[model samples]
Target: MNEADALVDGEPQFWGGCEIALNTEPLEVIKEILKACGGRLFEIGGVYKLYVGAPGLPVLTMDDGVLRADEAETAKPIRPLDERVNYISGSYTRPEDGWITRVGPPRFDASRISADGRVGADLDVPVVQSGKHFQRLQQQLLNNAAKERRHNLPLPPSAWGVEPGDVLQWTSEHNGYEDKLFEVEHVTDDHSLDSVAAVLEIDHDDYDFDPETDLIEEPDGVLDVDRPAPKEVGSFAVAGVANVGTNNTVRPAVSVSWDDPDDADVTAIRVAYRIAGQVDEPGYAFSYEPAAGQLLIVNLQPATNYEVKAQFESFNGWATETTPWLPVVTPDIRFSQNDFNAAVNARMAQLDTASQAAIATVRDALVNDLTNLAHYLLGQIAKLDDQDQAYQATQGAAVNVVSEEVVTEKQARAAAIQSVEAALDDAAASLIGQIAEVDDKHNALATLFGQVFAENGEGAASALFRLIAHAAPTGVAARIALEAKTAAGAYGEDSAALFLDVIAGVGSVATIKATAFRVQTATGFAPILEVQDDTVKIAGNIGVQGDALVDGSVTASKIAANAVTAEKIAAGAVQAGNIAAGAITANKIQAGTITADRIVTNGITQSDADSGSASGAANGTWRTLCTINIEKDSGTRGVMFLGIISGSLGGSTSQSAADIEGRILRGTSSALFQTSVVATIATGGAFTIPMSVGFRPGSVPNGNHTIRLQVRASIPGGVTIAASGYLYSMLPRA
Candidate 1:
């Protein structure tokens, strides 16, 4: 136990380092110091020592007495164990040849050995070529065989020193255990200062009696040398399984999650999947990194159930325990097909709804248009009827006038008839033009209707509507125009006939005059036929009708001078040739009866005179005495303005006499007449001066001409002119 005894009794070791000092008493620091000295502090054979240069090998014999499994000291009853199977069958691929080599027998189940003489479980490991891989397969198969029949040996408090990884030899004559090897796998330490004892749990191990190689036989009694020690087999678990999605063809996605373990030796995670009932067939196997525990399996059959398992691989390419199988199912393809059909039907329904809405809108607008057009046509027809009535009234008036008047009184009536005819012609032409305009409008409306409805699909309905809408106005305008024309023609004919009757009546009057002349010339009597009594007159109506009179039949040579009188002449029958120059003198003619139209050559004269006196007392300033506007006819020959100014100069003396001046101006021209008179009068005396001014504004345009009389006087006192002024203009013939 001392340092010098530990060095003499224990083995000597060499540690290359310099001597150093430490000032800590902690157990960790003591252990670190010893470890730095190339040694470890350990207890062996009830003695503690710092030993180096590797530990002693474990002894694997029953007579050594360091560890033993005695049945009498056991705390639990022993059970009979099943024998483990030997011989493994698997296939491996040689990387150089790319060929699979199968080793061992196919069928080797020990459970069936009693029935069919099969001795071991024929386990299969596929695609294993490397020596390390083969060794892993062999160890896994042996572990499986050992696990089938495991023995749990419990040790009492007396064996409290026994620890895990320690090998023990069991010796018991009654339970048929002689020289069987077991390793302590677990131990329960209950031996505190007050506790009674501890318990040791052990599992069977294949071991050997050799002093150098500590090998063991398998459970089925096959002594295999160089067997690997039992290792703690740990596996990553499949924590979660999920179905991500599926395609239209029913291909599914599956993802799995597992623990990473965080072991540097762990390289990857392995996944295997198959249909639920088809485990015998070859399934899918995939490998992924250990950090990524998820896997996705695709292209699975539709509506099919599946199972999956996951495991992890070590850096040595050895697989650990696999997770329990998980169940999944691929989606059905019919669901997707139903969804697609629903979408298509929904879209079609939307389009149909939109189309029906559009059709309804168009139909409503078309109906409104038709209603408006119908109303318009009715209005036009009403207007045409009014025009027709007006035309009829005009025609009736023209016709009545023609039928009521007599031809003997038609001399004055003839001119009235001509005027009426002219008016009727103008009215008829206007009515006709209006009717034509209506016809054009109707045609335009029809064309518009055709164009508007032609674009619609309802052709028959549109055509019927067009015809119905236009028929009334078209007929009404045409009928009115026809009636107006007929009335106009009748009125014209009646008027012409009436005019001829008047002409004939004038001829009859001439004949009557000629007969009188002939009677007077033949009998040499003043009266052709004298009446003796007042009642000696014809009772029947007298009528004189003829078309013409002979040229010399009614001459003066055939009649008495006073026989032909005013009463015998027709109103419009007398011409210039029928009267002598002096026959109708001015005194004999009626006053104002000869208008300007009857006097063709003599132009008109307008004259005005004023007699009021006007005076201006201021010197050297003109005063307008009077103003007159003379209307000169077009082609007026001359204008004359005359004034007789009479006034007295109040302050006229010999030294300073008063001078008065007068002037006449036309329009804006210079003085047409200017005169000045100087007189000397001590006491105011009257002076009279006559002024005459005339202008021949040659060929004066038709307008009113103005004349003004103005006078100015010298200083001290001014002269005044009595308003005896006259302005006149005479228009001569052009």
Candidate 2:
């Protein structure tokens, strides 16, 4: 086939231009060119080819009959079903600044983001210079990455010609897939089964992205928060008292007018004022308005001076520095309508007299100036007419002389060109001879280099062949030898610069015999790994096999939190000493695992306590002061009740004794488990009783028992009794 003719027929009709470095790899240049044009590079029939845009319409159908049923599952997803690739971010060359910049924000699919937020991808398209083009590429990549659903369809012998990158449509009611377009990503031919299987991916074109219509422009300018101050102030003054409120009340105010800042982002004008020479003491009065140009700083003191300034406020949270202070003083007194009228009339009378005098002076000057101009014009016109007549007589002779000079100049130009051509020919001959001589010298140098660099010869071994080695056998005088003959130097290397890429042959270990060995990074070289005695130490992370650790070798300090599982530790291996104090919280213990046996001796398994007042008890009748219910364990032995009761036996006559008693009762039964009679009141005076009672209900059922502290007075009239206390249920050691 004619190569040129084939290219014209097969290649794209449109032409495009690109720039690349001369020293760039051919494959890299090809890859960049393809990426810039939204194309893919592929190999077919042993020849590389380029295809642009999405694959063509489906040419094959993957219906139920074309799929294999033997496999347990046919439809699969390349990525997790919940993981979405909605956002695509990368860097591209910005044409405006000739620098690599982000392609605006990431191109995103809002629908996918709403469904699943794990959507992110980065695709570097360095060759794409236009921001719009870079945005389009990002959208395309996002769409491609979103096709996570894949299907492996096994086909019969009839479907043999399908290849990767071929577009196909699939319809499977079982998997709920309709007539969906899919791109073939991989194919495997089963020779034993006489069948072919293809891995198909959902095509990106179905997502729908148009480069021309759906483009996003790169944003520009400083952020709205960074807006600058307004450029100019129009006016700042103390206007006369005026009605400046909704009630039409008169008030002294300062008027400030400023030009709006040029920035479109400027959202408001901030005006501030302070008493003159007292800005730092009281600070400034700051107020902002949505509009610019003018503002009224009202409610100021009459006859007072103020220093006012204004600045700009952006829509976001940022304000410019205040402008220079503008000084203004309020009027001493409010000017009434009569005062304004009288002042205006006086100024008008003075201006009217001055205007009439100026008009008379202007009328006299015009008449004098017009007469002088007519005389000067008549004298100058006669002189110009005589000069024009003399010039007309000499015009013909001057034209003839100019024509002769043109012919003579043309003849001299032809002679100069002939001489220049002869000199150029001689120079060309000399240049060719010099070029030949240079070529001869270059060839001689090339031969010398070839001989010096030859692999096997009396010529020295080049640095290219053996990176660090002696060149020829001129001994130590000419070339440096790197081999360590006796390990004698301080660094242990035979040569000063023999430490890079040194190789010990198979069945031997290459040792870095220096105090430290460093690896190179972009910034410089630093030791990342070190050998200390029998152990290896790494500055960064190091991976080791699971079996590499010895039994019980990893201490608590070396272990990460939650790194050790139950399977990792042998049963009964963890002792009490191995656990840290408070390391095991209530949530860490499994429910129902802390039985009564696990509790310590005299643990006080359950307790309930309350403190309150009690009163309104009839003589010889009990009033419950506080009640506590304990759902104790079977091993609970007894409960302890302790508190103080203090109150006056009121309604008792002088010298009349009143007996008071405190008792602890179980449930609502009248039988008292414990009782004390320690209060004796001689009169209606105040009395204090210290009550400490303990109860042991020998045969009481274990679950949920109510205990109460009741107090009563043995006086004739109803006596008041008040108490406060606590209840504790203790368990004995097993």
Candidate 3:
């Protein structure tokens, strides 16, 4: 305890710099006051640590012990910026905001800091830090954070989906095949899409598509009407997709059948399609009924192919043209609505269970018309009350000495409550005139069985088995064998029962002609590709590899690059991504492009600095980036996300417009990446932008960046406006 006589009895006798109080408490009296004082603790955040200790006092608060001053530089002391010693201090068990208040010695408020002599020029660095500089910075940050969560996991097998967004191209022979589009903001429970699983926002340069694993995928370019078609029909059938259907009048019905020496009467049936070598557009060829010397037909796009020759009418009249045969797409059968709803709801819940059983057989024939409409509106409101002695002892009782069957059971319970309020006003006026035919029969059976199997056409999966047997009056092959699945691709693990976040993995091949590519690199879930085995499947979620995920249910704390990881979700939760919908806030969060690996949520209120990484995103203080749940002027806004987030939070590299949410809530794209980090954008607050864009087609892509608004100020400023159709500026850039 005589550490230099406790630093000369804790020095006080004022004046000429002679004091000593290095009681950092121990570690050999703070290594004899850091071998007598120079400096260390470079930087940290959230709590406290400014000890350049021994530089004769800057400020000390050890939870309030005392000694301070640096009032910006109180009388030329000039010292507090060697990495400012790290102190953001908002506290979550202290991340660094410690050493409360201190400015830098009014000559040490009458002196003290020195216990083992020397206290000032003690520099030789190395007071403690080395188990290999923190075990190689925690194994290079957990292997670059599992390679940055498999490099932003949007899943095109974790290589990232092809940049910007929106893609629906098609063509095979005359070139063109396209179909299966979906994305109206990542489905909001497509009838509980049978326990969700599909997320695709991808684009880390689309991993150069090398994919493989087989589904049929072979074809590739050329077929100006059978120039060399036939891609994978031999090795014995079962692997399909030719493309085109609905209204270009049909050609995608291929299955021509040859070897006919006696199957009689049919001539001229040979063909081969799927062209457009690496694309240049125009892949044309027509003829649904016009023929003569050679009607090779055209217009084949969206993944391609063409092969033709149809001129055999015969009844002994004179027709014979046979020479074009070569269409693909054979892979059929797909069933897997969670393994066919666990084998048709385990055989329809062992022959029955979500039990409403038609609301218990129409509530036992409307239980005496709902107990005679509640005794005819409680006896017509107990005949305008007033006699209320419990309706005067069963009221108006004078039926044959006490019972003509209780006066005909109160007139058949007041005529069965006026015939159950006239059968609930005639079944709500026949379901409000079939509410636009039940939204056109669930949008015409989920869009005519999704356009008969979304084009890999053979009359598009027999036109979706003839429009689900002309729109299910009964069962239509148990919901298309529970949304069929055989060629193998779609899957889910439990992203809160999934709509996205298997946390992320996307695969699609859909071919008309030009093929080859099933997904290569970043492989995790057992690499498998080749596709085209009658493609047309796409179903539910699809984040494509904007950066691999499949980990939802949030809980992650700090891991940045783009964002989102802390998953679990459910308190106003509605993520989406790729395009946008980011709003997870108790303090703050705004997602759209955090890429994905684990952002899920389930009621997380914990704020130990939200739990870690992404650089404490500034302790998320009031974290509002793009808020728009559903009512800006009124309020409840959940799962919302407007748009138009132009850009800028004051890094001022210039390029400023910033909007983010004029009105989004239409389902949100993973909370629109937290409106990207709205540096200072305020136009009407609660995040606003989206001016209604319509341009998606092959033009505005390549990550479509934005940032130039350099105004600098100094007398070069002006502001102009016209409003209406458009014309706004802040002039003075001469």
Per-residue lDDT of 1-734 in model 2, one digit per residue for the tens?
A: 12112222234322233567799899888777776666655564476655556566777877777765565446666677545578777776654553535456677888888878756877676666556556656766677667677777777677776766678887878777788887766567766454444555656554354545686666753323334444443443334344354333356777777654556556666676788888364433343543446777777788898887766666655545557877788756564565656665564554345333323332233223223322333334445545644654568777466756645654554444334333333322221100001122122110000001111112212211111222222221111123222223322333222323423233323334433444422223554456556555565445454457787677789989866554334334455776779989899865676555443354544556654567764467777777777765556654444434445555554423346666667776554355554553423344444444444435455677677776777665554554443333333211
Q: List the lowest-lDDT window of 10 residues for candidate 2.
A: 444-453
Per-residue CA lDDT of model 3 for 1-734, tens digit only, reads 12212221133111111123565455544443332222223222233233321112111111111111211111111222331111111101111213222121111101213322222211221221211211222222222112110111112122222221222121212112122221111211223222111212222221111223111122222223322222221221112344343332233233333233231333333343444233333233332222222333333333334333223433343434434434444333233244444454444442233123322322343343334433444554465443433454665544236566655655654454444455444432221100101222233232111111121211112111111212344322212211222223231211111011111123322222223224332324332444455563332233344245555533345334544333322222343554234444435654453444443332311101000011111112221223221111111111211122222122222323332112212233332222232222222111112222111112222221221111111111222111111101110110
Alpha-carbon deviation at 151 in model 2, angstroms? 1.3
Candidate 3 stretches with Cα past 4 Å from truth are 1-413, 416-418, 429-434, 437-734
TM-score of every candidate relative to the true structure: 0.18, 0.26, 0.13
lDDT of 1 by residue, 48-143 (tens): 645433223333343323333343234433222334454455543334333444353232335545543433444333333332333333443444
Ranking by TM-score: 2, 1, 3
Q: Which regions of candidate 1 fall more than 4 Å away from where they truly are?
A: 1-604, 653-658, 668-683, 697-702, 717-734
Best by lDDT: 2
Q: Looking at model 3, report the run of 10 residues with the lowest lDDT sum.
A: 607-616
